[model samples]
Target: MYSRLSFSWTASSWAFALLLVFPIIALVYEGLKPAEEIFQHLMATVMWDYILNTVLLILGVCIASLLVAVPAAWLMAMCELPGRKHLQWALMLPLAMPAYVVAYIYTDLLEYAGPLQGALRDVFGWQNSQDYWFPEIRSLGGAIFVITSVLYPYLYLLARTSFLEQSVSLMQSARLLGKTPTQAFWRISLPLARPAIVVGMSLVAMETLADFATVDFFAVNTLTRAVYDTWLGYGSLQAAAKISVMMLFVVVLILSIERYSRRKQKVFQKALTHEDDSRFVLLGWRKWAASLYCWSLVAVGFILPFAILINYARYYFAASWTAEFFQYSVNSLVIATIVALIATAIAVLVGLYRRLDTRPSTVLPSRLSSMGYAVPGTVLAIGVLIPFGWLDVQINDVMQWLGMKGPGLLFSGTMIALIAGYLVRFSAIAVGAVESSINKVSPSLDMVSRTLGQTPVKMVRRVHIPLIRKGCLAAILLVFIESMKELPAALILRPFNFETLATYVYQFVSDEMLEYGALPAIVIVLVGLVPLIFLNRSLEQAH
Candidate 1:
């Protein structure tokens, strides 16, 4: 009976993993077929430019994120600064503010007729156009800046954790050997944190590559934009799939490089004690400088954009508070709730399977299911359409053959495709959370439960589920928040006349009228903050 049960679990796990991964497989198959005329036209005209722009955007964002994140991380982890407790988590708030939102706010603030440039012209006694030079906030450089501002926190969180985990003994030894604080950081600390930094940079690069709204708003021609244009603009799924294949290659390359960098490189450090002596005591100017730098990042990244939204929401509240706004908010809430529950359920099932089964192959389901998180949303959207669209076609054809009215566009034309795209993109959050929680449960508990004659299913229901309930809740909330904020997939896969808060905000932002969308934008940011707060508390407790 036990052997049969194990086989059942194994099959179920593989089935779920394959269901989640089938879109990418279908995408590759479609992409490998003969190219459409539009794709050939793109290859002849501007495809190389799109590829170059994407490469440059990734490189720029990675470099800029490193520079911003490393110094702030070092300050927070190793140096004494004012408001350190609040500043530590405050740095992460920008992750809640979507990059496109920030781009809109900053462009409004800095454009020629906008407040900043207008004030500068008035104060400096400048006349008309070309009187002075101000950096354009709608160029490739602008996209890099706005994206880096929001994404640096990924590197910050990882790098700070790495710095905190380093042995204090190493720093003390370096200081005793006549090394200054900066020298010690360069030699002893930075090298040890290199692996973590590299991992963080890869994440930032993937995010920058996946970015569509900010790049599109800025009118930059990157691969994500190409994918969107090819599919929707030219109505050629084949060309879109081909472009998506290029993006998949980029994603795989980034992950490969990150893995290769950490290959055979390992560092072990003793638990960091909560000792004040571990931190460098900044004095006078240095102290103020550190404080200013940390706070500046918080201000630019989160506070300013958020503050602008608040102001807009207050004045435009009457305009934005209507039936349409309410409907979109409800739509976002309902879909996010459904996706959260389903994704968390999948996480629990696969997680328990990994824990119970001892075979090496049991690990593949969890790994395979998590790959969608790294895929760019536009690419994932195309991947999803290829298979689900075909399924919809098959369903309709069979119905017509049976002399019945066809249910038109059942899968690909409804919320089913949207939710599936979301699950593929965000299920990894729940899986990672559940897996981590499961790892904390002792194997002896499972053994004891089994020895008591409890079947695996019964043991899981009574023992595993109850114990990991908190992690499960966290997983649900994280997935919910991510779904609320996801724009590209929502934009591509939403059914006719269906709008989420993300799509609603993007619509107004695209029209250069953010005031109308400010209220919904605030909702997205507020929903996003819940997970960051939970994450911060968890990290605090763990450290």
Candidate 2:
């Protein structure tokens, strides 16, 4: 047994691991002061509402993603729908649309002054919202619909792969038993696909819990929105950290259920890749109807939002588009680019480290590092604050000792803070993508190199890295998309006078000016989709 870790692996491994673990520890430490304080706040005013809303949101997102993703995945994988080739890419396009962005777009269209109501007003000759009845766009149910519609891509991707790999023999047996196609799907295929659904749904559930932008935009008082309020409105990091831990508890439970559900299930073997020989050719009306449904889904998910955004972007040509705004965009691009590269690089090492080691310490680091993913962006924003404040204090003290002014606020307030925040929150995505791909690759490739007496580092550099290129690329794309769409953390952690598209939209929406927010909101959606396009393309080809 060589039992040797490379220098690059050791250093990069610990750096990335500590990068994730240290902030959480600091948060826990900061939060320890008043168990009573956070709890008291939780009990009196908003806890029940927060808890109830969070649960409903998670439930809604799960159901919605399943409805959209599972059927579409099955249809695409099992049935021969027209435009299936191009439609596959379209299905994933919605993944690029951020929840907050979609919420903004939906709210805009359905709002009293927006298109839908205006159209109704003209058609029915009604001038005010009071003149008629329509469902409120900002209500709990609306939040669920808006949020879930955009988040279902996770389910679509994972479930599609799972369905593609299902054994032909199993479905064949069901058909032989005279089960209808629909019955086969409901009974045989679905039961077997449960674990993959659980995996995909777990991500969506966490996403809903971790959501700050969508809930806040819809004025839903979920825990994530509460985390922001606790930290900013009251100046209480301890309270925020404690509340964050409450959300973390929910994530842990969902993950537990996921693990338990998946306990006996295995990723299907290659031999199980079955073609649907008895599958119905959806002909004439059914065929066109199926194609229409799939295409319409992509339309709502990708095209409609895009058209709306471009509509507002035209307004940008008349309004907020300026040299200064472009400069800020450049600044965002620079930080986003650096953070993506650094986080992905670190993720590669952590991913590789997992491949090489089975030690308890190594496994713990790998697992705990991903715990950041479960932390909502807003909670993570609060968690990162303790360290930043602590660092600033120590640095200022050093500056005082040097007979100079306090330490520069740049580290605490500006691009540095934003970059650090992105790395912490988004790196989990990067690690997941890289780790999945690494797992797919056979470890025997490395064994062959090792038997030839190549060093572990050399083995990775020459063998593992090249083979896992697709996974790495996918990971980078996922992280990049997520970072672009990030809202809660960026909203709270960004420096003075800084604005990303998400923050820009938030500023207007929070102020009750939906029109003011519409353009930037669209920009965010358009940008977020680019990587989603890449992600979906990767998924369709994953087989």
Candidate 3:
């Protein structure tokens, strides 16, 4: 009976995993089919531009993010600076500010007729366009800057954590050998932190590849924009799928490079002490420069855009706070809540299956389910519509054959599709959180429960669930936050007349009237900040 139950559980786990991964499978299948005319046209015409732009964007963002993040992370982790405590967490605030939001704010401020140029004209005593040259803020370079401003924190967080974990003795030994601080960092600290930094760079690269709103707003012809245009503008699913496959290729290449870079590299630190003596103290000019540099990132990334939103909200509150706004707020809340609950439940099941099953293949289900997180939102949306749309058609056909009026678009044209997309994109977060928590529970506990004749289900409910409940809560919050901020998926998958906060704000942004969307945009930022609190608390505990 035990063997039978175990086999049943294993089968169920595999089935669930395959179900989650089915969209990507379907996508690959569709993309590989004989090329439709639209796809062939795209390949012959503008596809090279798309590929080149995307590669450049990702490359620029990764390099710029590294330059910005590594220095800030090193300062926070290894140097003594005033306000370090507050600044450390504040550096992460920009993660809450969506790239599109920042893009709009900067464009408004730096446009030809905007205040910055207007003021420059006043100072230079010139009015016409030919008077002076200013770099355009709506170009690829601007997109790189805007994206790096927010995305640098991915590298900053990981690099900081790695730097914090390094042993003080290593730095001391380098210093004793007459190495300067910069030399020690280059020779000793950086090499050890390369794996962590590369992981951060891969994350930044993926995000740059996934970005649609920012790149689209800047008029950069990246593949994400190409996918969106091919699907919505041209109404060709096959073309969109083909473009999405190209993106997947880029994503796979990035992950492969990241993995290969760290394949044989491992650093184990003994005596991981971070006493004051280990820190390099900056004084006078250096102290001011470090403080200014860190604060500038926080200001440009979070404070400036956020403060502008507040100002807009203050003036436009009466117009922005209306029945429509409230309705969209409720819509966002309800959808995010549902996605969070369902994603968390799936995580618990997959995580527990891995914990209980001893076979090496047991890990595959978790991995398969987590793959969706790596897929760009635009690609995932296309992948989702293919399978669900077919299912909807089949359901209608079956109903019509039974002499009943078929329900129109049950899965594809309703909230179900949106929820499924969210699940595919964010279930990985819950799975990772639950797995981390479950790993902390000793195997002895499971053995003791088994010896007591507890069934796997009961043991999971009474033992593992209770132990990992905090992780479950964290997972729920993380998924909820991500779902709330998700724009591209929501934009693509939402049913007619459905408007989440992201989409609502995006509408105003697209119309160049972000003042009217300020309230909802602020809501997005504030809600996104919730996970950072949990993150900071975890880091503090680790410290």
Name the 10 consecutive residues with the lowest summed lDDT in model 3. Answer: 1-10
- Which residue segments of model 1 deviate by more than 4 Å? 1-7
**lDDT, candidate 2, 1-543, per-residue tens:** 236586667677887788787777777776666666656867697788888988988898798888878988888777777888788677887876766767777887888878888988999999787889999989889998887777788898888877878877777787789876678889877877788888999999988888887788788999888888887887777788888878878877999999998787765544757564545457778778888988888887778877776776676555666565576566657767777788788778887787786555666556656767777787777778789877888998899999999856746677777887788887877888888888888867777887999877788889888988988887776676677678788888898888876677677666756455565566666677677666665664665
Q: How do the predictions measure up, each by TM-score? A: 0.98, 0.88, 0.98
Which run of 10 residues does model 2 get worst, by summed lDDT? 272-281
What lDDT tens digits, residue by residue, belong to model 3 across residues 1-543?
A: 123247778887788788889999999998899999998888899999989999999999999999999999989888889999899999999999999999999999998988999999999898777989988999999999999999999999999999889999998898789987678778988988999999999999999999999998899999999989998899898889988989999999999999999999988897675666788888889888999999999999999999999999999999999999999999999999999998888888878888887767878988988999999999999999999989989999999999999999999889999998999999999899989999999999988998999998999889999999999998999999999999988888999999999999999999899999999999999999999988998898887
**Candidate 3 TM-score to native:** 0.98
Runs in model 3 with CA error above 4 Å?
1-8
The better candidate by TM-score, 1 or 2, is 1
RMSD of each: 1.4, 3.2, 1.5
In Å, residue 78's CA in model 2 sits off its true spot by 2.3
Collision pairs in model 3: none
The model with the greater lDDT, 2 or 3, is 3
